[model samples]
Target: MENSVIKFHHCEKDIYCFFVPEQCPVCGESLSSRRLQEAPVSIPSPFVNGQKIKCSFLVKPTKGTFLREYDGRSDLHVGITNTKGVVYNYNETGVCRDEQGWAQSVSVPLVQPDMYSLINQWDPYLEQFSLAEMWNPQRYNETDHNCYTYALTFINCVLATQGKRNLTKTEFTEKFVLPRTKKASRYITLYQEISENYFYIVDSSQQEDDNSSI
Candidate 1:
């Protein structure tokens, strides 16, 4: 079955990668508008000094829009533009509305480390599958893996959400999956099991006592 969620991968430079199709592959009909079926939510990383990011969910294009348009399109035309212009194939400019309002413009961001890639939606199945391939440093390419593309996509989303209150674990799971859980777990297993490696809790009371002692 097709994904009910309109997938968006975060990237650097304030860009989100979304899938959009131009015409029906089966019937070849022009597709119409799309809408987010679920509210946008985010996962926060505790290690990164607190960061909140959005999730992926179902999208309902205006009635009459064919599902085929979104199926095989590589153009990234994912969301409806504020101008309401016709959503183009492979278009990244249109598909970003985080449950608040339509966004006007979009751009992709630059991510470093180049190892762990992230997706907005968490698929338990993907974890196992991706692990099978594992991240081969030699095989890394921006054009190849969906992991890189989506990680790049979400990096932009993270940059967009910076300066906001970090999301709680509940918020993170409800919204997006923690990036690089599988591989990182091998290195940081202790951190993952306890807090999902999302946040670092600070004891304010202890800090005050320590200050008094000093």
Candidate 2:
């Protein structure tokens, strides 16, 4: 999914990243047209003391627009991005890189910026783990040992290198992965309802705005 939050100046600029919301969330200014960002690519980092850091990310296609172009099992092909954003994934063709298409991704930023050596070694470690014998193409299973398996295992390897606890399938899914998918699902549902009815007002008397996000 695209970024839903942004910084806005009272005076607009020249380029926009996503859909122009009716009003600016920051200044409460009405946006008739050209709700642009002056520095669209200069988004400030929220991690590592506001410095841009290379992070490992989990990626999956969010939803198809008109034509549903995706995997054969009607399931998404999951991939892990290296420090350079090169997507590595397993398929019938075995461990590969840069093959998976664009996806909605969530970054795994457990590694701190201070661990420079470990951060620098992410790519090689990931490459070594991905090439292991268990990830052979003939061993691939659409249901059982598949791309998701490769992603989790590789992540655990990286964690082990950093002397951290390996996340169980339950922990990884519940803690990191599912939360994002579920929240995105909620926003999509909300957007659809608003499109159909022009509004989706919540019961403010009973329940406050759902301020929490994944």
> Which candidate ranks first by TM-score, i.e. highest?
2
- Top candidate (lDDT): 2
The whole-model C-alpha lDDT of candidate 1 against the native structure comes to 0.28
lDDT of 1 by residue, 75-102 (tens): 3322211111221111122122233321
lDDT of 2 by residue, 18-130 (tens): 34457654456776645443433332322121112245555444344211232322455567766776777788889878633444344455467688887788888888888
Residue ranges of candidate 2 with Cα displaced over 4 Å: 1-54, 62-74, 206-214
RMSD of each: 23.2, 8.1
Q: What are the Cα lDDT values of the candidates?
A: 0.28, 0.57
TM-score for all predictions?
A: 0.16, 0.63
**Worst 10-residue stretch by lDDT in candidate 1?**
8-17
Backbone clash total, candidate 1: 26
